[model samples]
Target: MNVHTPALAKAHRFDEPTSVFARDVIHDLSRAPKRLSPKYFYDATGSELFEQITVLPEYYPTRTELSILRNRSRAISSIVPDGAALVEFGAGSTTKVRLLLGECRLGAYVPVDISGEFLNAQAQALRADYPGLAIHPVTADFTAAFELPEAVRDMPKVGFFPGSTLGNFEPGEACKFLKSARTILGKGARMVIGVDLEKDERTLYDAYNDTAGVTARFNLNVLHRINRELGGDFDVGAFIHRAVYNRDRHRIEMHLISKKALTAEVLGQKFSFRPGESIHTENSYKYSIDRFALLARVSGWSLLQSWTDEAGLFSVHALEASD
Candidate 1:
């Protein structure tokens, strides 16, 4: 499959200091031993690639979470009470979202993401599927608290943050994220967040560094993106994907390792990489129930309910603020 790299020459047109800072940070981290933020992993192409990854046999998070949402959607819908606006962070293809919308009654629907193009398209598709559901698509990075679009300002909210995507953030950041969402939502809002439980290292590693080579291409695809957008030179073939469990951190890290010595230029600067040194691309943190509760408490969110797969490999938690 061909992945198109967005020509960000025009990225300068809408340049914000934050975007520039992010761009530069990524450039510096692309060098050996450097690390890329997980947030950068989702340009349009990367986001689409991830949607494909979710369906792979090796990836069970999608199926497990969907089952939970399906089995519990009616019960969860009851918590909405006087009609709730359904807002999904990192909505992606929103495949599982359909099951919830079908089973639970919603007042409206909102999808928030950094990819305007992809977000709008999915929003349109959802609108067609659920004609009764008002669709509000907000194109912003909701990793931090962000203002909801005016269309959704007055609605009581039900946040759907499925797909253990929450694991991408460091524990502290995840807590802060929950707190921010609460402040935005006020007292009445409820959240259903997917949390991947601690699993064997072999299982975790296989998920990120898939044997099919798709994950590898996805990792190095960032370099191809930089080459296209930032005028950088990266030998895509020189890099290999690497993933491992950091037991202490309770997370899996994805990296792009240089297969041989190579140098690349970006934005008029050059970076060198030695064979085997890697650029960290993303982290997926696994949490034990005990550790997770502490995180929820710090974020001012109390765990209301937790659902687990038969093997306990994943969790889908119902969370709300304690009155």
Candidate 2:
């Protein structure tokens, strides 16, 4: 199978005899006792594990997001006008998308994801389900500057950003992402996004470090990724998983802490970890409604509608590009 990546893609995908997109940055991050970004967790196995994570009793983000979509879908359908392409940023499972397509008269469906293999498979299924609707699947990092095709470029596109994935980005990066969407959609583009609201620490803690053990696998899988991609030695069993709420940051942080002092090498790089030293894996930030609105305002998007769950555990917001 051939993957058609842009000029930049070759530098990123190693298997294609691709050029490396890093100046030792990849090796630097792969060293244990170091923190890495969460984007790398979508490797095939990690993606499947995340699907399992969503269903666990402790993981409420996906379930809660689905609930909001179900409760307000009719109103959301009414608000987002028809004859417009509904574009999702990281269209993973696309659990909410089926509801949108069935409830709303959408002209086209556009999904962008880093996992092209899974993305194309889902796109094929989506195409079969909605033969009348156009499916333009794009394989690119959502954080990059992408050029839309001519047909999609001219449509009154409405962005659907569910999953509270925006929280994954650091504050500045998140703002830039919102701004990029505005630049692409231009003035008059409507958007509906999900933002997980801040809740109690105890509740947040269990969601990431679940009793089911799948979340741990997902966290450690990053190390496995290093071993496979960059060549690393991660025992995958010599560490303990941790998740905590950083009150100062208002985010849940996941960590893998070494149980004992250990030395390991990966892709020709040596690393040492103390017994208590930890590698920060990911952070899931929960926002207050006011904070989220401020983020949208500062990013050049206007909040049209915002609704919280009956329990106020999550929020679904409708926003539009202002400039």
Candidate 3:
């Protein structure tokens, strides 16, 4: 796959930030299934809401993944070559990357995220904490192929994809993402990824359905974004957050259910929803160790090592690009 450069992205009409948001929202809401891309869930408000979700008592993935990272920092850092560039995909917050920065020897840090506002603010904060480290922030959808900064092009690259963000993609897309990442990072590159593990049904449900309603706000923030950016008039309060685990798929599905029959307009187009109708928002797929290992192998990566918490709630893996 070719890298999507900033110039190339601007040349396409659909690539315009507001145009894409308006187009996708109208097209998706018109469809029978009525679904939206989870990528839209990262405007400044959405990003802030998600950070809150991570700390909620019902959420376990963040804490569990952090524990694994803390316990295995030495082994994880060993894979990084000195003077290497760490490129993080969908890097919303600096919380997890801080651990790696403290432990690893690196030349620069590149955070690629869709939310430019949040990304810049975090980059600014990082600069204050790590004065010597070079920080490059790229504002683009990480799901699509995107070029790294020219400054870091010749440096050895290590991909950091934490927060189980890989789970947000469908299985096939996840594999495609690994392949795309391999292409972006180039040969001899290494990746450290975090994956949520299959666990009790209740645990999966609780994580997205937090009692404090932070996750709920995070889910609804997409609609809020549509309103703010695309001149949409959605009754954000008319929808309720719903999360359920699909056993066969081994993923938690988050949806916004309509409280009543309602019509919403976006970009001068109207879409109607029936009572109980849902707009599917996000999916968090839990992976077994063997399954994720196979995913990496087929996507041109070799799983070098994996670490898990004591209860096996989450996993962190070290991967090497394979020829």
Candidate 4:
């Protein structure tokens, strides 16, 4: 793959290449209730499908969060120290960060993501757009341990985690991620995060289950990835996408239900699925403002400020690292 990185922007990789997908997929398929990690849903095709999902009429999170960021960019910029390096965890699309880049006078921008090719392409575009600012794209799973670019080590760092991605993690995992981010950002670091607000069940359900079926394609892209990259033989048509609100868990659960009894092979291993068995794919948890504030407080961050849209469908939060 040809990844164009400008002279001003150099890419970094913290983890070595490995067949983590094959190992995890085989193991998860053998479980009583089969499962797959959502991280796998970011190959080129999956990423494109997700970008489509963000624009669907039923999906309010993306546009709502964008509104909050745009309306509150000034206030959010106030909290960021001058010359601070902005570190974005799971920097998927550059759409949201452009607001910050245009608003804040940051010394550097570091976009960390698991998709190396996509990340590099975005980084190249950012460098051309912002020739004066430094751009360092790191290809690593932000949820795991990874080092920031040495160029920005001594510079103060601010974390930017948007799109209500924290909702993807369970409560405990969310706490762990917040704590890990604190450690990564270091002392006196501030964080700007986006959290989806808990709202009517119908709205939440519709957000994940769109009428255009783009979200369905995004969910099934995982199996397609397995087939392409891992030499798996999965009847992509035999499994249908399913997204339902799990009220008791306060999260949206995405699954792939087997259309009928079938067997799929991957890495020379075979797995059988019952007629109606499902492979749990992803979870997106919504939080009330107070609930998320409490979560941040417990996770080593003091909630500095939280803003929501007029309809209160989504939220943006500013946090300061606690002593």
Candidate 5:
């Protein structure tokens, strides 16, 4: 469905193929332990697989966070000033943002994502539903620097970063990202972030290793993406999905282990993997409420308020940028 009631939303591309994806793939695969950025796991196929993962019975973060949003949307909207620009980072299906849009009278809505086509389609759907809302979709890596649309520049900006995606980054990188957001959104801007709380090892393990194997497919799809986009010769079947809870690190680690010794070539470089060798793919760090608050403080944000589900499996915190 294409809706042009509030003007056609324009998409801006900042992640050039030769510069970002290809370069990062070569560099990351060349590393000692061998790793790929989680950001790469969001191609069209990967993105669709992830949406499936969120609904799996074992995946509690999605539903738990959604409950908090649905129940507290008014309380959440109260903090955001009327006519403020809503800038969402890593905007995926645009599902969660719809809850905010229902209550907040946003001046403009900007959804930033790397998957341009998928993002544009979601934005168009949103436009049809909210005809009066100004929707500006930016197709760019939210991690890297990118400019907001000129139209939203003068409007007060409120950042929305849900889905516990902050857990993907290590503490240091997460801090850097928060600081960057502070600069981009400017002072007085507030950010609402979803964070997965530290929970039982069993729960964490089950969440990543769903019984339906959707998470496994989502993990393996990364290799398919590498082969399809970077010209990598990967025997996708040769790798098995593995997720383990790292107690000392307080995180769940997702890896793809080689089922047998094999060699794969990408970007004209061949790499050999020993039997059982694994490429670290993703990490989801669980944080306590206090721990995350400390992180926000260090990153130049003061916590305004936080909401959690009855089980406390997930949390959504509103943080105001400190001057």
Candidate 6:
């Protein structure tokens, strides 16, 4: 397998950022109730921290999802047409996809992610392991519209969006994304996605608020990235990390609370944080199977089949495009 790490000279033509990181930081921080897009949390350091988070005993999503994929991969692969291109959204580490790749004779593999360097490195390692497989790594925000390489354009596409990452999006945004994917993959294409099921409050809370503090670091690393890339002065220690289940919203919300009244500078602009004010960083939504199936229907996918662990803590659904 030949590994292609094409120069990102034209990356900006696709979904690459056109504005400075500072601009987004300033705009979001200046909002009434400040919030940041979770996409920013995947810079090299943040990505590493998150990888650590997945392994911590308190974080069950990764291990549980892996178990489901491992046991069901053969059945999962059976539905995927031979020679179908496997396109994964937010392909971090490319670990879970390995299960399916081992079972399926795919025409090509496309892993889309925002972290270019990380994505390339993982893709190269995969190339060495799967020599016969075609590996095309596209470093772009999977949430935005981007073109698939011409190599996979003719092949039937099977989208793999595991890890319940879809839970990060608001329902409307998720719907829009599903629509965009339908356009990209065309009719009859299938999408296999992991969905975190709505469980007990304590279970959900512990998953995000890990005992290891890895998740906390993962959340604060956003501020660290701002300090490094945007020349912001942030006293990382001045903020307390928090993760709470919002029962009404059916999601876990992560925030950084200001320990004291303070002012921070970014891009030469000052923003003030009152004591106890929180900058909302991320939200991970959990869903019931019925709720998700309803979402899939409205989003243009027919829920073909779903597999769950014995405990029903998580689920993976195989959905076919209705159009």
TM-score of each: 0.91, 0.90, 0.94, 0.94, 0.94, 0.94
What is candidate 6's lDDT per residue for 232-307, written digit by digit as tens?
A: 7999999989999999999999999999999988655678899999999989999999999999999999998999
Give candidate 2's whole-model lDDT: 0.80
lDDT ranking of the models: 3, 5, 4, 6, 2, 1
Q: Each candidate: RMSD to true structure?
A: 4.5, 4.5, 4.3, 6.4, 7.2, 6.0
The predicted structure with the larger lDDT, 2 or 6, is 6
As a whole number from 0 to 100, the lDDT of residue 319 in candidate 2 is: 94
Evaluated with lDDT, which candidate comes out highest? 3
Candidate 1: 10-residue stretch with minimal lDDT: 1-10
Candidate 2 lDDT over 46-119, as tens digits, reads 88888899999998888888898998888887767778888888888867898788798887888987778888
After the best TM-score superposition of candidate 5, give how far the Cα of residue 239 lies from its true spot, in angstroms: 0.1
Superposed model 4: Cα runs more than 4 Å off = 1-18
- Candidate 6 segments exceeding 4 Å error: 1-20
Error of 1 at 13 (Å): 3.6
Error of 2 at 219 (Å): 0.7
Off by over 4 Å in 3: 1-15
Question: On lDDT, who's better, 1 or 3?
Answer: 3
Clash pairs for candidate 5 = none
Colliding residue pairs in candidate 4? none
Output the worst ten-in-a-row residue range by lDDT, candidate 5: 1-10
Over 151-252, each residue of candidate 5 has an lDDT whose tens digit, in order, gives 999899999999989999999999999999999898789999999999899999999998899999999998998787766799999999999999999899
lDDT of 4 at 77: 86
Clashing pairs in 3: none
Residue ranges of candidate 2 with Cα displaced over 4 Å: 1-33
| Candidate 3 lDDT by residue in tens digits, 119-228 | 99999999999999999999998988999999999999999999989999999999999999999999999999999999999888888888888898899989988887
Backbone collisions counted per model: 0, 1, 0, 0, 0, 0
Deviation of model 3 at 189, angstroms: 0.9
